[model samples]
Target chain A: MNWAFFGGLLSGTIMYGVPLLYTTLGEVIGQRAGMVNLGLEGILLIGASVGFAVSIETGNPWLGVGAAALAGALFNLVYAFLVATRRANQLASGLTVMFFGMGISAMVGRAYVGGGIAGLARYQVPGVAALPWVTRTMFNYDLLVYLAVPVAVLVWWVLYRTRWGLSLRAVGENPSAAFAAGRRISALKYQAALACGFLAGIAGAHLSVALARTWTEGMTGGRGFVAVALVIFSKWHPLRAIVGALLFGGAVTLQLQLQAMGAGVSPFLLNMIPYLLTLGVLLVWSGARRFAAPGALGRVYSGEE
Target chain B: MSAFTSPARRLRGACAAGVRVVRKGWAIAAARYAIVLAIALLAYAVVLLLAGKNPLQAYSDTFSFTLGSWYGFSEVVVRMIPLLLTAIAVALPSKLGLINVGGEGQLYMGAWLATWGAITFTGLPAAVFIPLLIVLGFVGGGVWAAVAGFFRARGLVNETITTLLMNYVSPLIVGFFVYGTWRSREVGASAFPQSAAFPEAARLPRFFDTRIHLGLVLALILLLLFWFVLEKTAWGLKMRAIGGNPEAARRLGVRLGLYIIVAMFVAGGIAGLAGMAEVSALHGRLRAGFSPGYGFTGFLISWLAGGSPLGILTMSFVLAVVFSAGSLLQITQGVPFAAVNVLMALILFVVLMKPRLLGRLS
Candidate 1:
């Protein structure tokens, strides 16, 4: 209601929403390329664990972020091998990848639990920093938060503008047709997988190295799933995903704020807000957005094989 | 009429025929399962070695604890009860090309409603109370899953996402009640977030002085019924038709929406029975987070078994052994319990790859 409350809510939204935004952006790429990585939760965990461990060992958060990104890309190759190469069912493959992620992350992160890092530094925009209310809410954040929107824009540009993007879209729209037109369907899918992994890993790193600033087992929770739902919410568009992620982020921030304020609602019930909102969003938009999905999305492409 | 055989001879002939059928296929199926297990274990052993633990010792410890003792073996059977029920929950819907991933949520709702019945009907006789709890559990889970089925039926949203998302919500709803009005009011128990203990009559009867309960019988009955309906009944034939080709089935006047809703409801109801059994027989009370991912494990079991009745039985037993071994490995290998997931995922990966080794026989 008041300025401080409103400002805090807005600031919290940026802090929490940024990670979801990055994940949504990553999944947007993968889904657009006709692959759906349900095992994204695992990807995020790998990034979070590897990022935190490297940061702790090297005492350089940037190195940790880099390591996390590479680890994620590498991990995704396993999923790509199963889904893209072996022609396994995508949903089952994704779930297996998720189980693998959960096991590996727990094993890898056991020693680093509760360990902290001098995480990404926050910066304030010079002019906006002077404003009374806006300064507190919008001007200051870690580098990832600042880059989140621009990256979404960049993703949109690449996905919509480039010739490579055109080939990729063609492949997703109709792999057989794309193959006839000389696009390498499997190769394009792999490229999309790599890009998706890199972004998802960065998203994980943001959780450990920037937001949480500490490592723990299962730290990413189900945010990966929320991002999956958000992709449908955004109608598979990068620009639209920015709004979807922020709305989810706002829902999360609102719940935490309400719980912290000692509102009469049980904290357990309050925790349901984001997930319920995801279901609600899907229910409302999925009927309309069914037409917006890539034609060959979630299907295993056999043309190249 | 002159060639008519005696009843005893006919019975013997039928038994021989059944044996011949099993002989024809089970060898290849058994070999495939054995190879899958070997590969999974080899991969998990490598992980153990990398983690600086002795792989041999971990395997030995797991087997010694789970397979070498009667009590441990019984525990596996106990674990398999819920896994079987939930697996059937998944396997049934899957027969119609529906992915019922909300087993966990359905299980919780079943337990929640069963608890209500147990607490309220405190003085009822065991004969009456047990069936009451069973019905309540079934209704709870059925309604929970039907919501998702309804959405899918109306073509509003995919059941996969709705069911998956709803899985996260159902537990919180249970938590809300368990932490608030349902909290055990007993002075010493207030610290724990669990409901009051069920009356003696509310609990499922156990067997052989072990934890194994009547849910095993219920699960076996349901599994047999599942096989019969799918293979013998016209309803099952309609469902298979729908799964094989929905368009053709629709043209034949099979109500796709009705089948979807009813199949989901029954599948969810089965999963609910698992929850009810766990609360009444295993824990004797409703506790927050009572299940350690039994519903999810059931999904994996159903998938690993390819949704066949006998396959469900075999896979549930195998995974139950793994579940039992998980705790032993934690202490002996100095690794977290989650390390079991690696083995599980590996098994699934091998199966999902659909290896050509058994291509001819399968």
Candidate 2:
């Protein structure tokens, strides 16, 4: 009710929202290229585990972020091979990649459970630091949080403004057409998968190195899925994803805040809100947007066919 | 010469031919599975090698622990119950081209409702209560899935996304009850978030001193029922038509929406039976987080099997062995239990890659 409470909620939203925005941006790019990496949860787990381990060992969070990104891109190649190269069913292939990610991340990160590190340094916005209502809460955040919105914009520019973007979209919309136009469809898909993995990895980095500051088993807790839903909510637009992620982030933060505030609702029921909300949003949005999904979204693309 | 043969002799000749055809079919299937499994195992061995573990040792230990003992074999059967039901859950709807990833959620809901029946109708006779639990479990899972199916049938949303999202939500709903209203208050067991133990009547009849229970019968019956309904019935033909071509089926006057909704409901109900079995026969109470992704595992099984009953049966047994081996591997291989997922995923990937060897050989 108070300004302080509202500011705290807003701040919490940014903290939670940044990673979601990153993942959503990545998904938007991949989906725009007509590939949906449903195994994103696995990618995030790989990134989180790798980032947390590397950060703890090196005593530098940025190195952890880089390692995570590299690991994610490399890990996603498995998915790229399956769905893009082998022309497997997208949904099934995505789920397998997810299972693989889960297993590999758990295997590698096993030694680092309960591990901690000096997290990413938070910075205050130089000018906005003096704002009256939001100064203390909203004006201070980690490096990733500050970069999140700009990254969305950058992704927007890359996907919407570049010729490469155009070709990627063409491949997604119609692989045959794109191939006829002289585009290497598989190559574009692999590139999209890499980019998606890279961003998803950073999103994982934010969860471990910058947010929770520790590694736990399956710590992402289905946030990868939340991001997937956010992609739909944003209509596959990176710019729109910023708002969508924040909204979903608020749903996540609200339950925690309410529990902390000694709200009467069971925390378990409250926890269901975000997922139910995603389902609701999907129900509402998916019905009307017959054209939103890329025509080749889940279709397998066999080369020269 | 055939024209001159007796009628009985000609009939016998035709029966022999049918038997030979069936045997040949079995040989081809066995060969295909053998190849898929060998490739999967080799890939997993490489993974083990990279992780600095002895691939040979891990495989041997997995074998001896899972297949080497009578008790181990029984446990595999027990594990197969849920895998079989859940796989059938996925397999049935897949016949109609619908993905029922909500098996996990439906399983939870089924368990939740069955728990209510178990706890509420304590005085009912065993025969009555058992059937009641079965009905409750089916309805619980069926209705939950029907919501998603309704959406898909209405063209409002894809069942895949709705079911996936609902998977996250259902567990939370179960948690609300288990940790709240349905919370067990047994002495010295308050720390556990679970329902009170079901009465004696609610417990499914078990086989010779093992966890294997009536759920096995239910699962077997349903698997047979699924095959029969899909292959022998008019309804099955309609569903197959829907799966093959929804637009064409619609033009031919098939009720696509009704079929979709009904298939999802039945599929969800089968998965619900999985939940009921797990809680009633295995745990004797509904516990939070009881399933370690049985629904997802079942989905993989159905996909790997390509929705064939025989394939589901074989894959579920294979996965059950893998599931049992996972815990043993954690101890012997110094790897985490989740490592099984890697192996399972490897198997799935191998099948998905669709190597030409099986095709050529078959």
Candidate 3:
């Protein structure tokens, strides 16, 4: 392949991968803290619709980004209350919240569809952007793409290197033990869920304000679902989430590039590539003996005796 | 074995079993469902208010439009054709502690294979070819579902994730045919993205002067049959035992993997029936958006019903009524279909109210 074609594929990966990274890392945290937000797809929709609308109205992508995260957090507040305090089933509750979020987003987003408001403006870092080879190959994306890397690293650090991370792990592994250890297991779960929701919101903001630049009903498609599966495939590790997201991003970009170069297969058939690859990865990874997960992954925790 | 025992001893055993039946279970269940239903309705009312419509008026209109009229009631029964079949697809797998969320994908494969039968065996008599289409639908969906089952049974993959992912994939394969090779080639209809309309003989016959098709009869019969199997049969007890505790069942010599595969195959086939109904009866031709989210809706139905066949039937009718009126909500109140989705979501959320029986994942 020509260098220009290769560059286009890499750029596509970055565009798609960054948002996935945000969602996957968020899921890693949520699952790590003994909760699984099946409603993530809904959360992303809310974030995308709200983020896109606010940015359009205010003329500030940052404002849109903040609004998206807030929307996600507020939505999760209800879910966390139900699952954490009300002892609802995590899986069912997440699914409900997901539908609720999608409905709310669609109800308001109908007006904003097809309105072409500009996305986040791209600006170059002075020294880093000017490097002879680096400038041409990297550091050339929107600020969000660049930020995703460090944010992931920071998440990794918190999940592995801090006491809070340890407490979260304890809760995920054995909530009863964490409770006996004097950790506020339910409160920690809510915090983890809320923070994860905030990240999912930013991920949606990336899709609307920086990538697709438009809002649509269920625009997140199955990517939110993909991210949830990615967390499991990566074994709930933060850094591994980045790798997994990029690998998926690369698969998607590769197919489009193949189509552009006149691949003979029908585009609809070609669209199955990423999903097939995901299945393949999941099948292979699940075969591993070292496949570890949070002990109490989907169980409802009981704080009282 | 027990039925062959002496009559007097059997009477004593029957009395003991009757005593074992939890009478309080019904009252507790009713109370739990009441609270959850109320909360879900409250949530729907909140959405109605936000849309600037009077919640009470919209509720009355919805009831009158869907349940109050003969036409609306018949329409609800018609919608329940697919819902009924798909709900069984879900409940069967769930009884084995597996979430067969691939109902959507299996449904798609059913439509595809049934379409092939309709198109290929064009010269066959209506009676022969119609049954052939039904068989093809079952085989197509059964095989598709068995793929996830094989993975979960042999590959240790989580059925929930795999089935959900496959659900996203199956619709695309159908779209490929509808949008490309199978695009209607009739003189004036080649412009539309669909198959050539089936011959009259290929169509499923409707009951006298109504939209309802024979699939409704078949679904009702199957529901009664499956309920008997699930409640009174020896094999059904084994399936439930396995679902309750896989490790214990394994210790007791239950063939875990084999039963799981069988359960998944049956689940997928039942779901396939839903797709067959949609294609063979309602749509009359395979097309895009023919059965969007039908599988997911069925999944929610089974979960709401808590795996009871009768509960599934009742819940299916309730949801069918809600969906039958979804369009009226759109036409009259300027609400979106997402509003119905909102309602379903809220209803599903209340399943958590009584977690032990309904929301028990495994």
Candidate 4:
């Protein structure tokens, strides 16, 4: 491809992939704490709808993002109770949270159907935006795009290099041991989940108010679920999660470009590319014994031992 | 060595102990369901009161709307067709400890394939066309599910995400066709987009002059067949063994990889059949909103039933009643159609929270 085409492709991929990256990074933290929040999609939907509604009402996109984060964190409170306190099955509880969030968001969003809200204003780094090819790809993006890379790095630092990170990892790896060491396992789980919710909320807000500039039913469009897969594909590493998001994002960009080119391929078949890729990636990752998951990923610890 | 006290005797004793353990486990499960049911009802009453409607009247209306007339009953059965198929779609994979959330995508694929079959075979008789559409739908769903299964079995990928992502991908595929090559040219509607209608020969025959069609019967037959397979057959035993403990089952000579793929394919095929039924038997064409969230509803039903076929049938009907009545409540009481979804969510939450409401049955 020519330089211009390559630049266009890179920009398109980043624009499409930024939301996925944010959510994936958020989920990487949650999974590190041994909690799988299947409700990510629901949280994203609520965030998108709420963010759009609030921004339209207030004419402030920042407030909308904050509201979305609050909504997402509030939703996770229930998840924390079920998975961390009640000792219920994680998978089942997560599914329940998902359905509940979806229903509530749809109900809350009903009045705002077809309504549009102004999205975040693009930020320009004076010198960077002036560059020939990289300007459009890197310099002209909303605040969230800038936030994603740092958040990924911060998550990596918190999960690996810090004392808090060690405690969290200990809880996920062996809750009993963590408890014996005086760490509050449930509290730590709640913290991770709430943090995940906040990040996911931002991701959702970015999707509606930044990327699509509109809210619709089921608008998150399974991006939350895709984020969960990205986490696995990244092997739970924050930086790798970004890479995974980019890969998925590239697939999505390719589909859109192909559709635009009118290449005569059925759009349905074209749309299947990302999902098919995810499946392929998951299969390959899961087969490698060296990449096995943490010892106690889904099990609930009663602290009996 | 003592010939009378051999390793076979120890194996038999171990088998007995395993049976006892399973029985105890069932007992706990049953008690959990009982508690959940009671809690769900209590939550439902609370919601009814909060909405400013008489709890008794609202519930009565719900029951009457679902069962009062032949038409209402037929609608319930028609709704059950998708719920039944979708439940099986979920339950089967769940048996293999895999969550196939991609049922919605599989359903869309099935509908797309069925539509293709209908459009391409315009001159065929109903006898030839209907079965072909059904088979095509199953094949479409099966293939869709198999992709995820193959990834899980061979690629070591997580099935949950793969299946879920498939849902978005599948709908876009349907959207592409309807918005492009398959769009009906003659319709006057400005807002809604859909495909060309299937010919009469491709439509499913109605059941006893009611809106319900033969699809319900087919779903029920499949449920019965699956129940027998899961509960009585050697293959079912192998599946259960794998589900309960994959490592142990593998040691016992079960083909873990093969079963995972097969189970997912079967699950997806059932979901596909639901899509086909929706197109041929109910809507007569594929549209943007053809599913009405049946895939997710089926997920709820399967979980509520705890993966039992009989339980799925019962819960599907109950869900159908709630769905039908929700629509009625919308028109009569000015409640949103999604209010019923709220109730379902409440029920699900309470059931999962307490899990002791439906004593000795789950």
Model 1, A242-303: lDDT tens per residue?
A: 89888888888899998888899998888899899888988888666888999999988876
The digit string of per-residue lDDT tens for model 1 on B206-251 reads 9999999999999999999999999999999999999999999999
> Interface RMSD of the predictions, in order shown?
1.8, 2.3, 1.9, 2.8
Every candidate's TM-score, chain A alone = 0.97, 0.96, 0.94, 0.94
- Residue B204 of model 1, lDDT score: 96
Q: What is the TM-score of chain B alone in each candidate?
A: 0.93, 0.95, 0.88, 0.86
Give the CAPRI class of candidate 3: medium
Q: Please, what are the lDDT tens digits per residue for candidate 3 over residues B1-362?
A: 26689998988888877766655665666666667667778878988898687888778888897789788778889988889899899988888889887888999988888887887777888989788888888888998999999988895678888888888788898899888877888887777688877777878889857789978987888788788888899888989999899999999999999999988888898888788878888777898768847788888888788778767887898788778767778888878777688888878766664455342542
Candidate 3 local lDDT, A104-222, one digit each (tens):
88887877888777788776656875554443644467888888989999999998999999999999999999989999987898899888899999999999988889888888868
Instruction: Write the residue-wise lDDT of candidate 4 on A1-305 in tens digits.
Output: 46656666677788878888888887888888888778888778878878887888899988999999898888877778888877777776777777766766766676778887668988876687666666465557787887888888999999999999999988888888888999998889999889888888888888888988887777876788888878878887888888888888888888887887798887778877877787667666664533445557878777753
Runs off by more than 4 Å, candidate 2:
A303-305, B1-11, B355-362
lDDT (Cα, tens digit) per residue for candidate 2, span B1-362? 36999999999998999999999989988898888899999999999999999999988888887789888889999989999999999999988889888889999999989999999989998989999999999999999999999999999888988898889888888898899898889986678888988999899899989878999999999999999999999999999999999999999999899999999999999899899889998898889989988999999998888788988999999999999888888887779988899999988788778845345310
Q: Clash number for model 2? A: 0
User: Model 2 misses residue A137 by how many Å?
Assistant: 2.9
Question: How do these models rank on lDDT, best leading?
Answer: 2, 1, 3, 4
Residue B28's C-alpha lDDT in candidate 2? 89
Q: lDDT tens string, model 2, A1-305?
A: 68877777888888988888888888898899898888999999999999998998899999999999888888888888888888878888888888998899888888988888879988888887666666476778888898888898999899889999999999989999999999998899899999999999999998999999999888988888888888887888899899888887888888888998889999998888778877788777775576787888878877674
Candidate 4 runs further than 4 Å off = A1-8, A132-138, A257-270, A283-292, B1-61, B185-193, B329-340, B359-362
What does fnat come to for each candidate? Answer: 0.73, 0.78, 0.67, 0.55
TM-score of every model versus the real structure: 0.95, 0.97, 0.93, 0.88
